[model samples]
Target: MAEPTMRALLRRRDLGLRLVSEEDALPADALDRPLRWVHSSDLADPTPFLSEDLALLTTGTQFDGLDGADGYTGYVQRLSGRGVLGLGFGTEVHRSGIPDELVSACAASGMPLFEVPYRTPFIAVARAHSEAIAAEAYARRSWALDTQRALALAALRPRGLDATLAELGRRLGVWAGMFDATGALQSSHPQEAIAPEVLALLGDRVIDVLTRGLEAGQSLAIGAHPFMLFTVGRGGQLRGVIALAIDALDPEARTVVTSVIAMAGLALEQSEQLARSRRRLHTQLLSSLQTDDPALARRVLGSIPPAPVVVAVAADAPVGPLSDWWERLRAEGGAASFVAESPEGVVMCVSADDEGLLDQAAERFGIRIGISEPESYSAFSRAHSQALAALRQESSGAYRYADTVGASILSALATDEARLVAESRLAPLRDHDTSTGADLERSLRTWLEHDARAEPAAAALGVHRHTLRSRIAQAGALLAMDLSTFPARAEAWTLLQTARD
Candidate 1:
């Protein structure tokens, strides 16, 4: 249904209205212009009271005092220029019939003129228009309520947004499409009907929408087609955009579009909420695994891969693509693969045999990965250390597996325990050096580094072999450690590594 237009009002012949202008003067298309309200003003300059698309009725009371054709012509021209739908001249109150000058002026200016006989009061036309307007408004309200109900039902369907958008497009008799904030097309109905030009138009408008921060709906032209765009959210949030192809949207169609925007915005919000919840869970699980809390990690993740797990850490990796990698890992490694995002990079624990899988992924995604040797769940912390060590050694942007035996001793203690052991064992030496400014600990460290070779140890210390040996003997005496024993040498080396770890 259409709004109350001039053509619709003119069809009511009960008031006996007559068109005084040339029959062809009123264009058929112009008759459909919407009529806001019926207004009657006798003031010569009633432009202030009148607005566009209104039919102005007059009695010529003010015109009776004016001079000849110029006054009447100027009067008609003023009404026409003010964009009134038409001028209604009421006869017998002031004039007997329509003035010839006014008729000619109306024709020249393309303004439709009508005559109201003595029997027909200006109030009669106003009353008829008022009733027609009320009827149209009622019809529109009824249509709007019906459309809203239909949209609500569509939104509740099992398919959710897809069915809702399809229903909208069906109702509007056009193709409808939705796009997320990333300019990715989420969905579209009757995909074949989505012309390339329409997508291009939306692309162009997106730039404008982002730059100008447009939150309201915008009606644009795509070639000869009409396109209506509405932001799915408010306050510049831009949850998404809904676009439909239609020449002109009536009140009923606009009502449907608005309902779609509301539902779509709600759906988008819910989707984001779910994603955030999953991300929080993933982060929690990652924290537990990274902190070497295997029990907590298993509890948080709900399950753990079977023993001999291969842990890997990546450096400078893109987090956005990690989600995709996780899903891919689940496909390839099934229940044996697990991935999580860490602050430094992404971390993963897969079956030891899946080392080749990590290598393939790193190559495919152009990322560097560091893999640990086969280790049980009890050694997850050790595996992480190996992975980190391997990561530090990586410089070729390729995956590197940890040298199991070379770093195995360091992995025996988790990072924190190693730090404690190093601090406790080296405490006496550290305190003595702090007070006396001695090089006893440094000398022992140099000797151990050179495999107890006095010549190299002396060269490394920049001292004579005798002096180096003397410092070592002094360090052993101060700590009550036997420097000549294998157990003592091993303990010293382990302490040295912990201090560095």
Candidate 2:
């Protein structure tokens, strides 16, 4: 399916073309240059009307009455400068043979010179090249059809997406990679074909396009490596991107790529639908487990996570990506795990021994997770409540129920409403201290910390007991509360504990 070249034309027995210039005079790849077309002109300057990569056939009429080699040299220079592949001389029609000066000029300029005998018309050469072009085009079309059929059959395999991508890479003789909606590398043909740095660059470009939510293709080169990236699925709902390591594709090759893109998009859409149904089933199974009936859930899932399992709840997590992660784990025969969408966010039940999976998920997705204590399926509801309580704690990354045990009551009361009430209740003491330039609020908190005692509180504050007592009394007066009463002291302690710094 390659274009015809000068060497190919010279091999045509019917054309009877002969290379007049010495082989050494031509550039190494001169004869191998692809000939786009064959044109004949008798004008003194045909450079303006000619294009690159084509042969210009003409009789030696322009050389008539020419004296020196200057005219011939300029003529050859013009044709070469215009990117004309070669010059063909039609002998006998003008002066029985190519002029010696013209041949010398062509040799000096490295212009490929060939002879067109009187018996062979210029039309014959053009027609032969045109026929070759048509034959090449037809062959390409046929190859495209056959490759499309092969890709379709590949899509019907067990691992349709992977199989189709592999087939595409094989057919195109290049590397192919598939990224998921989260911009994670899902699959790649010839898995390690791309270097890590190149892959990182590709990932960044893919993320940029995905963030824009566009259905488009981009051609880029990282150093000497070239890549063609295309977004799969529709705009604003893109499933992923497919990257091919190639500089450019012909029209027929583009048709093949387009077909693969459509197939990949369809496959990913169907995967999304199947994931939704699977999540629904997981949610129902989780609900069944909450009812203290593990048997029904176990029957459906073959087996649940072992008795000592911890339930994790993550708010605003990407359920699709997490589900895909769990699916991969299952495929690898890792510990049994279940993921589902809940009112809180995404919920997962995994073995306590495999809690590291939760850490991995959190790190991979940049999400915070709350994990409960290890408990049996019989207490699944309680475990879920514990995880929810842990989720409410002021923490980042993975917050566990165990980490909350014996923690500060302030952590539990760390909410907007509680902070507002605390600020309001302690405002009088704060304002009074600020106005008087006294440390009454500090003394009061110190006294509370000392179990409402005076001597130790004074020692802790580096002040006399009488001084501490006096500050406490002043604080009580400003707050309009009796400092000696249990209710007043308890209320002050609670307010101080709940207020933020």
Candidate 3:
């Protein structure tokens, strides 16, 4: 935090800082250290974009040679009023020794003015300031590395998702929530509802950092608040996202977050690969059983024994920290994956093969999980569907196939029957019929997506406004629901979601 003094600045100047009036008000201690870009605009008011930290290097050129009857006094007054740190008045070009009126105006306004003798170029000052700031930043980074190591070694309970997120939030001194690429909460600290603003900010960053097929990590500052980000990768494709926030965190805290994010990313990628392999095996085993040949099914099962698996999916994700929570979930269970997404909430694909895996994950605070019924290797697809259905119902209890009649029986209590019914009833609105159009449902969605702006939606869809109006009218008539209504909108949304599924 050693700031550059006026003496240091003067030394950096090629002609050396000469004492003209010998009445320099700013002490050597008060000169700009890390000055933001130098400004010498001749505009009467350059305050449109210049911030407070700017070192305004004007040459009295804006006065138009005192074109106004008030002399250059008014011009000086305006610059000082704009919160400029100091003024550099060019002396040689317009020499009559800077108008006494201008000097008096600056002094009275409490603005520091420096005489820029004709010999000195403003570029020199800009270059010197840049170097000073760069050096200071480098020192901070070096200190940051050491602090990071110390933070990593801090003792904490060996728990799962909740513990991980809580630890990070505590260390960073900020409320932290982990999101999957689709922006679902993987794990959160000070876990309250997240604001749309926060989500939007992180979401934009995630898209920027991750490639369609690649997953990686990055960091950014939003409104001056620092955040660390990571990518979820699997099967040679990016899976989800992770983000952590640290506002005014210490150097040590920042380093610790960086390390945690990196470690988390590695863990998530590994678990995802494991999940994919298990899923592939499960599919192959089940396919053999479905082939109507018992012996072939046996051979398939013998080739790849059915084992348990776990699932996790991308929720409302952005370029926030993804790796941390995924890793924690893995430690709690045998494996994890970005399962799938739906409006109800994020679903995780967990390989709960062994006994007591759910309890183990819960004990570690791994993730909020609802397990499905278990079956042998020959029913991978069926097992996966049951698990997903159970999750969709948002059941609090762990469901087992054995708990029901048999593997063929899907646990009726495991799913949200009411929601399913509602969606099913609205199926027509979500589906496409030849009488309507190839993508009638999609067209309806696009129309609604633009906030019901008929003209804009029609233009974007390459349709006439009248056509869009007629389609909406026809959809309303067929569904027997006016989608412009709030309740109707919700129903329509559910319909669209079911169709997408």
| Best-fitting candidate, scored by lDDT | 2
Better of 1 and 3 by lDDT: 1
lDDT of each: 0.76, 0.89, 0.56
lDDT (Cα, tens digit) per residue for candidate 2, span 1-501:
666899988889999999998987689999998789999998889988988999999997888888999999999999999998889999998788888988999999999899999999999999998998888899989989999999999999999989999999999999999988777788898998889889988898888888899787899998889999888988667899999999899899899999999999999989999999999999988888888778988898797788799999998798987888888788779978888888988999999899888988888787889999999988999899888888887677788999888988667766779889989988988987888899988999999999999999999999999998889998899888897999999888888888876
Task: Return whichever of 1 and 2 wins on TM-score.
Answer: 2
Cα distance off (Å), candidate 3, residue 296: 20
Better structure of 2 and 3 per TM-score: 2
- Please write out the lDDT profile of model 3 over residues 1-501, one tens digit for every residue: 454434355556574544333345644434544455566766777777577656677666667646543555666566656657667677777665666766666666555666777777777776776776677677667656654544354324454434655666665557676665444556677765346677677676765565454454466777656766666554345556657665344554555665666556665566567755644554454344434233564464442223454332222332123333444455565344323233433444444454354444333333344454544434545654554554444334344433444423233432356457656765675554555545556667888788778999999899999988888877776688887787886666555544324
Pairs that collide, model 2: none
Error of 2 at 481 (Å): 4.8
Instruction: Quickly count the clashes in candidate 1.
Output: 0
Q: Which segments of candidate 3 are over 4 A away from where they belong? A: 1-34, 37-54, 57-85, 88-100, 103-132, 147-176, 181-183, 189-230, 234-236, 244-262, 276-501
Q: TM-score, each model?
A: 0.58, 0.85, 0.36
User: In model 1, which regions exceed 4 Å deviation?
Assistant: 61-68, 92-94, 171-175, 204-228, 233-238, 245-258, 276-340, 345-501
Deviation of model 3 at 43, angstroms: 14
RMSD, every candidate, angstroms: 8.7, 3.6, 18.6
